[model samples]
Target chain A: MTEAILKVEKLKKYYPIYGGVLHKTIGYVKAVDGVSFEVNQGETLALVGESGCGKSTTGRSILRLIEPTEGRIIFEGEDLVSLNDEQMRKRRRDLQIIFQDPFASLNPRHTVQRILEEPLIVHGIGDKNERKRKVVELLETVGLNKEQIKRYPHQFSGGQRQRIGIARALSVNPKLIVADEPVSALDVSIQSQVLNLMEDLQEKFGLTYIFISHDLSVVRHIASRVGVMYLGSLVELADKTELYDQPLHPYTQALLSAVPVPDPDFKRERIILSGDVPSPSNPPAGCKFHTRCRYKMDVCTKEVPDLVDVGNGHYIACHLHR
Target chain B: MDLDKAGENVEEDYVLEVDQLKTIFRTEDGDIPAVSGVSFSLKAGETLGIVGESGSGKSVTSLSIMGLIPKPQGRLSGSIRYKGKEIINLSEGEMREIRGNEISMIFQEPMTSLNPVFTIGNQMVEAVLLHMELSKKEAEQRAIEMLRQVGIPRAEEIMKEYPHQLSGGMRQRVMIAMAMSCNPSILIADEPTTALDVTIQAQILDLMRNLKKDFNTSILLITHDLGVVAEMCDRVIVMYAGKIVEESDVRTLFKNPNHPYTKGLIKSTPRLTSEKQRLYSIPGNVPSFKEMPKGCKFVPRCEYAKDICYKNEPELVYVGEDHKSSCWLNIEQAPSIEEDAS
Candidate 1:
């Protein structure tokens, strides 16, 4: 049996909403509420939902980029939440994150070589000469030329900048990489090239990925397992094929149906939800999706459905599936 | 509804006709040809989708048509015929009358498009009063009606609020309302939904479709997402390296894409039905404007490039009744319609 590399148990992150002249904490925005999932060794787990559904916050919390207000994160048998600041800094070498906008994440003043070498320097990987060589090697591994090392971030196109970002993420030789909407900003033709390069790098380095994106078609392409998040909670988690073919949660089904298929012959019955996603600071009571769900029952509005196992490693949080 | 009537008259009644429109930017280095010799016509009430990767001149073409391209640095050439008059050489005052009154545009980023200092009501009222010759009170009422028409709940309250107070989706709806306030003959949307969420994207697309029906407006929708083009457009124009590489009706373009670039684009996108282990990506990158190829721009990256393709540029040729492609490949030599399925 395969071993789980990262285990998150009921992780929660809530941002305080300050009000009044004294800036008192009035309420909390429950960004990530009681979310739990596991990523197997060298596997890709995709977290998908709408923009404010807390997918990005969940990814940030798992890496402790943002401190979780509650719950445990067990990585390689160590509770990351229990680590001190200095110890967590040291452990950061084993975990890294790649941001969505490559141009924003990378420093405009720094050269490509400097950007890639900073991670190695931070983790105390090698000396000057070794770091230089490692930077060139990393650039080559991400399908970039060695001569591009001297160029600034603005000199490269969006895709090349993203490749530089990927090289920077892999410089530490991290065990788990959280890529947050990495290729969504890129063009269609460039997107596939970057995705293929990512798959190749994953195989070469045995990297575990937590891919967070709103694009379901892209998630379907890369993820071995998929988790659907809605309004700060995991609605459904299952294998890629099972989730795409037989989605248990109504929200997941609606999301899948909403994606416009490429072919004209294949007609998709678009599930147009009437209203916008409710504010995360004041989510609806009970099931968060009950307000827009077509199959809402009386129990759905009154009771929160637990994430229950529904045969063959699938988990769903819906009263109908229960 | 009169499908035959609509189909037969589409070729004759074009609200806007752009012929060989070229826009070049005079950078410090040299003249960077952003848009080159692109031609297309938009019939009344038809949605034309202009699709391409970055730097493919899709947005540039739309901006040139709307006379929104910045001056001094950029130079516009060729004919942009709107209502049987060439708009490319129109003076600033004349173009100002055309802009927002006859032709309006919605940009990709709503936050930047909207003025931060003013309330939504103030902006909409100003727009309506500027073009419609309405009184301030009448304009305010019209602005409220526009807001309600765009599906913003509690129109009066929303109109009183500032742009920052609204969500991204609401802001986009406000933008649509402002653009539609004048009831322009042509609407140019340049990646309007690219910054929006998927569900919001669908809602906005549906709203635009409904508005097109109600207002009978011609739309020029520019985007890189093929999924949107497939769902929203009656016809599509595929651009590559500052040129229109292919143009066809939506069904024919998806069914039988002619140009190598178009084929590469469709193949690279990961669809819901695609079951391949890995996606088919186009090789290499889009050429920079300064270093464009001498012959066909797509030859360096095309899989079906031949010796003739690199030596000379190919003219846009008629491949079907309403389909055209700029490629050296002989479309007539290919198999029948049934065998050319994508």
Candidate 2:
């Protein structure tokens, strides 16, 4: 039940929308519109919503780092949107990422051993003292201390510069990372020590993540299949305890009853969803979350639903239990 | 709730007290302190909260209770008092006549805390003509009635619009209608919806619980969201690397959290109705006050430390009935709750 290792499919990215001073186009902002999922292998998926819901442009269009205009990411079985940027720069060394501002994603004049030895010197790997012992063993496996690898990223601390951006996305050993809001600019007691050092470096490197967040309680603590995203499509995916115990999308039960649960007599029934989100360059024409659906129907503003599954593996999209 | 039988008319039962305050900063690599001995009080439409994270001094104790710090480079000290008076060494013309009329903060980037070339009706009529005696057409009719009591919708065309013409939840409801246009009996706010959007942080926590039930006000609030302090505090405190490692009543600090850094910030957050598979996280790094350790600052990230919690400094005590905590393991939590209920 676990082979996938990234699939994606209907994808789409869009942008276009020009118009002001003779610059014509004027249309698309769809931003990852027909999104699809898969992930599997070592698990962790996530991708959540809200904030123009493209879920960080579907985690930078599965490492094409934004340039999707349409379908198929595939990975490990090719198709990273049909490669070629000289074979997607050798498939960007098994694609890595981890951004969300560890004080503006590091490099305040680089130092943590030249930012973990510039990704093992751009994946050339060993040549200078075995790239300074793999940049001091990726700064002691992201807990840092190879004598603070000559310090710099403004002398470390937004949880040691997100453990030097998770030791520069595990210096090229990355078999898929894409972490985006990696602990949303940290400090909730260092976001659980960088989500338990990204779940102990994905159980010591069998990796495959894609996390991208909007903090659904840090995606119910490091996902393992979640998805959701809205304006730019893919309405739901499942298992993280069946989408936090039975969500089946109404925007995942108003984003898991709009999060906020640090208990104080944990009450429930929230589902607020009133106004805002709309314009992904003029979105609404169909169930683009039927304008913040509280189960809206009447073919939710002229059709579009389609995600489907509804069984043990949960998938969703809408038309109230399709 | 009884912060030691106060006397000297501390404003007839606390409307903001503070006491052991502190602050510090004047650094040439020296006195950084940053709100060390912070005390509490609030009461009258209560709320309280604080919590911590990020050099835990909860925005320098709400900028030393809004005398907005920045003095001879931050150096504040004990008492703050407010209605009971002291106002931490007043005079910057008696603290700009108790700034925004007896306290009113609201920060966490309402886009650089507003003022992109004025016009939210000239900054809510220059804070209501610098603390009320009104007049530029009666402070533009009390800034269009605080931009229509903060729900802002054509409230006189959002007083000629500007803070980059709205939306980040309408510039945090025009910074909560310019900090409740001088309704200040203590508002402060700080991480006011940490740059929003969880459906506009549940519509700015339901517009700050309906402006604290229509301005009975007493807020304070600072953040680091323990779910916005269990949806708008009642009594909290917590902080860390700069003291008060726990104080209670937000349902007994979310049901019995007695400081091992408030049970590692309520078992390192991530809840949305619990599932866990490893995430308790409080292991090390937060000492900083140029490496302060040798005795509790969560003793090098605690796992219930032992040797007198690394040689001394515990004292917060009181457990339950206004549940305090500082922790030398709450003096063995009544023999570890009778050995975990036999």
Candidate 3:
């Protein structure tokens, strides 16, 4: 097998819930509870879930944007979580993140050229002339003309702003990119262009991506493998085809069914869950999806299901699947 | 499935008609023609979907019909007829009476649409009392009944709770209840379920479908998602750069899309059964209002643009008896199977 670019083993990111005037830690939020996955070079691994499912937290934790309480994050065979502040800062050059909202993530005051050149200057990659040339090259790579580089963030449309974000992420020449809902804020037509651009950039640069999104259709379009998260834990992980064709987890099945098919004649028997996702701080005792799972049994409410490897590289965490 | 034939009878049954409506926003940069000549009509008990990307004038059209477009920065010019009555020239008091009583709208974000300071009961009761000449006690009773109709449990207690106290789905349902409280003849829902999760979105769509049947209210659904439109709308209007590029029954619009933009949109969307190597994306970004191409707004991104497409805008031409699309290509002469395969 080819070497994995990034391997996460038993990662856990728990936020301490504080209360009272003293602000003492009362309980844990368990944002990312014992989740683990690998992203191969030149492949996209999509992490999908609804809001409050900790998918965003997992992406942030991988980049060390937010510190994880416990876990092992191996990047290029080096333990990222164990590294010190200075070491991690130095290592950040190899890892980057593209946030969800383009307007919010980019500085309105800075021009597109400045946004793309800041990473090179911080890393001391090159001098002013070299950095300027590199910024133009990056802009061209993302399908934007060099003349538009001097424009501010608000001057461009949402799709163009996201392209600037991608150009900035590529400026560092990172091996792995954790794009958290990169195109979710964009329009439907613009979403496809961005997805295609990301794919093309991956092929040209040999980059690995952990694409986090709530849209299943977009995830299925771009992802080689997919991981479904619930509350704070990964409920399902499998190849994209296998996961879409034959989802094993109850949550995964329900999620797939809930996605509206584009064809009007294609009538899908939608499995509508009765309630919203429970809060991470007060997740159900046993299975995270037991509160919403239609196939929940007595054991589902009492015992937490273990992620078991079914045949053909498919992994599922559910009592029914077991 | 035979909605193609039903489209021919739409003109006879339409309750609301908007003819060449234009809403221009006076931005600091220039007069941004947000919605240029948008025209479509809604039948009394039918659901008409207006779909487009961000800046494609989907929400602006709905806002123009509701007379809710903020003034000074905005100016609307075009005819809007409700039950054959012109709404563009209606007095403020006349529009006010028609707004909640004859027509109501649900915004994309329910959290922002609802007032946090007021209780759900207060909002619903206020809406009812404003339209109907009902007492406070009568309005509160009707509000509780409306809450229960929307699938909220303990309607009496929910009425007492503030907007922040309920979940996102519940708050949306409350918005729906408020919109329907006045029993408006036409309801405009603008991206009502876009902010919701998949499961909750399904529930909300199902709720809307059920409510439509129960109340017999016509719906003008505005959304960027074709899936929701497929599930809810009877007739679909595909918009781009402030113009309707395609209008057809939902089934025909999906089965045999004509316009290059519509075809690209349908193919670009990731479907549940789609197993393509890569999604077929249309090239180029949507042009700004000031920079709109003189000919076709979609010519820059369209795959089938010829020399003729660059000089003149294509009018909405009849494809089938009911299906219409705006494209320079003679769709009848083009390969039929190729369009279906997309």
Candidate 4:
């Protein structure tokens, strides 16, 4: 069995909502509430859900980009949560992130070379000449020509800009990459190109990926294991084949069914949830998805179901499953 | 689906017919042809989908039909017939009569399209009051009724709420409510669900389908998602570099896609059942206007490009019954199902 590269236990990130004249803390928006997962080495673990499911927040928290309110993020036997800012900064050399929007993420003023070299420079990896050569190598690794290195972010297409972003993330030779909706902003053709590129890069570098995306099809393509998050908690987690084929959780089933199949003749049993996802700030008790779940039970409203592995690593959190 | 067979009674047959429509924008760089000589017809109650990437000119075609293109900078040519009457060059005042009353449009970004300051009722009533003749109180009731029809909960309360008060799904439902309030025969929805999440997108698509059935409204859906097209559209037009590469029924387009670009698009989209293999991707990017190839616009990316493909472009020709593909291979001989480039 593959060894775990990162293990997150009861991870939580809550933003306090202020109210009253003195702006006292009224309530907490539980963005990521008690989420737990283990990402194995050289495997892609995809976290998928609708928007505001705290998938992005979880990815950020794991990287220490957003400080976790309470959790133990065990990375290489060391708790990342306990690390000081300076210590965390040093650890960043082995951890990287690729953002959703290539247009917004990349600095428009800086050339591709400068953007790629920035991480290397920050990590104090190599000297000027060596850094320059490394930048060219990184650009080539991400499928960009060396001549285009002098061009600004605006000069490249959406696909090429994402390549530059990947190149930047790879400059420091990170082991784990948290790519947050890496291909969502791209066109269909370009999206495939980038997805393929990412897959190729993963194999070449033997890297682990925490792919956070709302798109199910893209996740199905890239992920070895899949975790379906709802409200602020993981409702289901399993192997990609098991998750897609037989989703135990109601939210997972609904999410998979909601994805429109491309073939016109492909008839699918769609579980169209009645209303929008409930507000995360004041989410429903017990199962947060109880408001939208079709098979809502009495136990669902009063007691939160624990994410317990049914068998073969297929973990489900639902009253029905219990 | 055949325009010639529809005969002289074009108004009674097809709701909207766009013939050789061309829209070009005069930019600082040069004049870029956004939508060049694109032609298609929409029958009443029929959903025609235009699928393409970002700069593929799908949105431009819809804007041209709406007469929403800004003059001086953006020039529009060719003919846009609404119920057999040429309405392409109608004056702003003349076009206003047909804009919302006869044909209405819903944009991708509901937030940007909807005015934030005004309440939902204010916006809905304004659209109804503009093209429709009704009292303010009557329009308010109509707006609430429309909101209720689109599946918005607490319709009365929602009418009082601003655009910001609602979720992304709710905002989109409101947008549909506003678009349908006038009960336009032809509803032009440009990526209405693109900004939405998968679940919300499903909701919106379901709403659109229901609304179409209820109103028997002809829809012009402009989107890049083939999945959305398969779910919603009857006929699909595959656009690339401001030209229609293929046109067929949704089923045929998916089953037996004729154009190389069309095949590439379908294969490239990561499917739920797709094996964990390297996704087949088109070799190169869409050519810019300044650097468009002399022969085929897709020649730069086409693996099967021959000598002829680099010299002269192919016209949209019939490959099968109710199907058309613009490719040299289609003209040369029946295209063999070649394996995708590795």
Best by TM-score: 4
Query: Candidate 2, residues A1-322: lDDT per residue as tens digits?
Result: 3799788889888889888899999798887788877888888888788787888888887888778888898887888887678788767888888888877867688788988888787768889998998889888888788988888988777888888888888888978888888788777767888888888888888887888888887877778778888888888888888888888777778878877888777788888887678888888887877876777878889988899998887888888886
Highest lDDT: give the candidate number.
4
What does fnat come to for each candidate?
Answer: 0.59, 0.65, 0.67, 0.82
Candidates' lDDT values, in order?
A: 0.90, 0.80, 0.88, 0.91
TM-score of chain B of each: 0.96, 0.38, 0.95, 0.95
Once superposed on the true structure, which residue ranges of model 3 sit more than 4 Å away at CA? B1-11, B330-341
lDDT of 1: 0.90
Candidate 4 runs further than 4 Å off: B1-12, B334-342
lDDT of 1 at B256: 86
> lDDT of candidate 3?
0.88
Q: Per-residue lDDT for A113-197 in model 3, tens only?
A: 8999999988999999999999999999999999998899999888888999999999999989999999899887788889889
- The predicted structure with the larger TM-score, 2 or 3, is 3
Error of 4 at B164 (Å): 0.5
DockQ of candidate 2 compared with the true complex: 0.23
Docking band of candidate 1: medium
Pairs with backbone N, CA or C atoms under 3 Å apart (clashes), candidate 1: none
Worst ten in a row by lDDT for model 3 chain B: B331-340
The residue ranges of model 1 lying beyond 4 angstroms of the native Cα positions read: B1-6, B331-341
Candidate ordering by lDDT (highest first):
4, 1, 3, 2
Task: Write down the C-alpha DockQ for each prediction.
Answer: 0.70, 0.23, 0.72, 0.83
Please identify which of the two predictions, 1 or 2, would achieve the higher DockQ against the true structure. Answer: 1
